[model samples]
Target: MFFSVIIPTYNRLPILKKCLTALEHQSNHNSVENYEVILVDDGSTDGTLKWLQDHQLEFPHVRWFCQTHQGPAAARNLGVQQAEGDTIIFIDSDLVVTENFLKAHATALIQASKISDRVFTYGRVINTCNFEYPTAEPYKITDFSAAYFATGNVAIARHWLIEAGLFDTQFHLYGWEDLELGVRLKKLGLTLIKCPDAVGYHWHPPFALEQLPNLIEREIQRGRMGVLFYQKHPSLEVKLMIQMTILHQVLWGILSVGGRLNERTMAGVLQWLINQGKPQLALEIARIFLNWYNVRAVYAAYREL
Candidate 1:
C-alpha cells in the first residue's frame, strides 16, 4: 500500500459516518486502491464503537481501534503506529473527502522532491462545506508551499513523521500541534508543499449561537499558544503583532460588555499590555474590558447548558 488514512474522532458518530461514506467513494476511484483507512476512536461516549462494529463494508481498507480518552494527538499517534503504509494521511472525522483528494496528496508527496530538493512532503486543508460558508473551487497542487500549510488535513511520510517525533502529545486540545510539527519539519530543511488539490467538506453542522463560549475558550488558548510560538521564534515584530491582536480582542470585549472587566481576562490583557511596553495604558483598558469577556464567556456557557 502507498498510503494509510488516519482519522481520530471523539463523540461524533454521525459526522464520522459522513466522512467514511466519502472515503468509501474515494476508494472506489481508480487512484485509491492502494490505500487503507484507519479510524481510531478516541474514547467516544457516543455509539460510534457499536456502529463501526456493525459496518464492515470495505471500499478502501477499513480498520478500527479503541483507546482511552487521551486526546486527538495520542489518538493520531496510535493510528500512525498501526499504519502499514509508507505514507500516512491524517483527516478529521468531520471532513468528507473529494474524489481526487487522496490522489492529490499522494501525488504531491511523490513529486515534491522533483520541484525542490528541499521539499520532503506536504499537506493541505481546503474548505468544502457549502451550507453557510462559501465553498472553495478546485485548488492547484502548487498551493501547498512552505509559507502556507494547514494541518487539519495533511499527508506526510510515515517514517519521516516518526523521525520528527510525531505530534507533541502535550497539546491535548485542537490547536498548535500542527504548527509545532511544521516548524520542526522546516527546521530540518524539509519544505511542506500545500497541496490545494486535496479538498474535503466539513461535516459539522453550521455554527450555532449557543456554542460561542467554547469558541472563546479555544481562542484564549490559541492566544496563549501564540505566546509559545513567539517564545520559539522570538521576533520583535511577531511579538508586537500578537500582543496587539490580543489587546484588540480585549478592547472589543470591553466595548461589548459595557465596561466591566473579568478577572481572568483582565490578567491576560494587563500581561499582554506589559509585554508591549505600555503597561499603564493596558492596565487601564483591562480594568474596564476584562469583565466583558468574562460575562460573554459566562452567558455563552449558560446558553450551552
Candidate 2:
C-alpha cells in the first residue's frame, strides 16, 4: 500500500534533516508507487522551508506544506487534509529510521489488512541522543513505552484518522494530543497491531542542567494539556494516563517531598550524572521533581477549570 508519512516540525531543523534523509531511502523491497513525505512546517523561524525548497532534489518524495505558528496538532491536521496516500504513517521530525522502515510497516500492515481492515500498525522507537549515529543505539529498558497509539512511529489507514476527527487542535501544548486521538480511535474499534520490524530512532539532546528550566516547563505544559484531554473524555483510564488521580498526586508528592527535592535541591546530583556521561540516568532522576511539578500543575489546571 502507498504511504503518506506525515511529519510536523518546528525549530528542530538539525535532526529533521536526518529524519528526512532516512525517509528518502526506503528499502527497495517496498514498492514506491507514490510513497511521499508530507512535511507540515509549524511556522518555524529556523529556515526549514527554505532548506526544503532549496534541497528539493535531495528529497524527491517530499511534499511540504506551510502554516502559521500553530501547534503540532494543527500542523498534523493540515498534513492529513492534504495527504494523497490511502495509508498514513505518523512520525515526529526528530525520528530517524532504518532503510527497511517502510518495507517492514508495509509488510505488517498488508498482513493485518488481510486479516481485518480495522487495524493499525505501531512501530518500535528507540530513543538516542547520538546525532552522529542515531540508528545505532541499542534498545534499552528506558525505551519501553506502554502507549496505545503514540504518533512517534505508527501507520494507519487514512479513513480511520478522518473518522476519528484527526488530532484535537485544543491540545496546543507539548503532550496528550496523540494519546487523546488514540482514545477516539480506540472507541471506533481500531485494533493496534505491533510491528517490531519497523524501527525509528528518536533523537533528543542529552540531558543537561541548563535544560532543566525548559524540561520543567514541558512537564507543566503536559499537565495542562493532560487536563484538557480529561475534560474531553473523562474516564478512569484517562485519569490514570494523565496522572490526575489521588494516587499520582500522593506518589509524586512523596517522591518529591512536596517539591523540596526539586531542581534547586537536585542540581548538583543531576549535573554530576551528566558529567559522568550518564545523561539518561540524570534525566530519569530529574523526573522525580518533574513529575511532581506535573501532578501539581494538573491539579492547578483542574482547579482553574
Best TM-score goes to which candidate? 2
TM-score for predicted model 1 compared with the true structure: 0.70
Which predicted model would earn the best lDDT?
Answer: 2
lDDT of 2 at 179: 94
Note the residue pairs that clash in candidate 2: none
Query: For model 2, where is the 10-residue window of minimal lDDT?
Result: 25-34
lDDT of 1 by residue, 173-260 (tens): 5455666666677666777676767776654443332334565566555555555555556666544433434565456665746544
lDDT of 2 at 205: 94
Each prediction's total of clashing residue pairs, residues at least 3 apart in sequence or on different chains, is 8, 0
Model 1: residues with Cα > 4 Å off, grouped in runs: 27-33, 58-60, 115-149, 226-305
lDDT of each model, Cα atoms only? 0.64, 0.93
- C-alpha positional error of residue 157 in candidate 1 after TM-score superposition, expressed in Å: 1.0
Question: lDDT tens digits, residues 219-250, model 2?
Answer: 99999999999999999999999999999988
